[model samples]
Target: MDVVFSDVKGMKEEQEQQISLVAERNNVSKENKFHKDEQRKERMLELFLRTKESILEGWRQW
Candidate 1:
């Protein structure tokens, strides 16, 4: 009976550890996705500004 109890306790601990690892991985993935999105937004803004400047310069030439 004691051996069976010990086995059950060990299994429970292992399951908890797996759950913790999965949660950590999910958090990291969310952070990475947010960072990528921020980078994409920054690039798009830069492109927009450059295009606007080009249009203004062309008007000046005219």
Candidate 2:
């Protein structure tokens, strides 16, 4: 009986640790995805601004 109880206790602790690790990994993945989305948006905006500037420069010569 004592050995059974000890085994149960150990299993509970291991499960808790695993849950914590999984939660941490999920948070990091979310952060990385968000960071990538922001970078893409910034790049798209920069490209749009550059295109506009080029068009305006051409207009100026007319």
Give the alpha-carbon lDDT of every model: 1.00, 0.99
Tens-place lDDT per residue, model 2, 1-62, is: 99999999999999999999999999999999999999999999999999999999999998
TM-score of 1: 0.94
lDDT of 2: 0.99
For lDDT, the strongest prediction is: 1
The window of 10 residues in a row where model 1 has the poorest summed lDDT is 1-10
Off by over 4 Å in 1: none
Per-residue lDDT tens digits of candidate 1, residues 1-62?
A: 99999999999999999999999999999999999999999999999999999999999999
**Candidate 1: how many backbone clashes?**
0
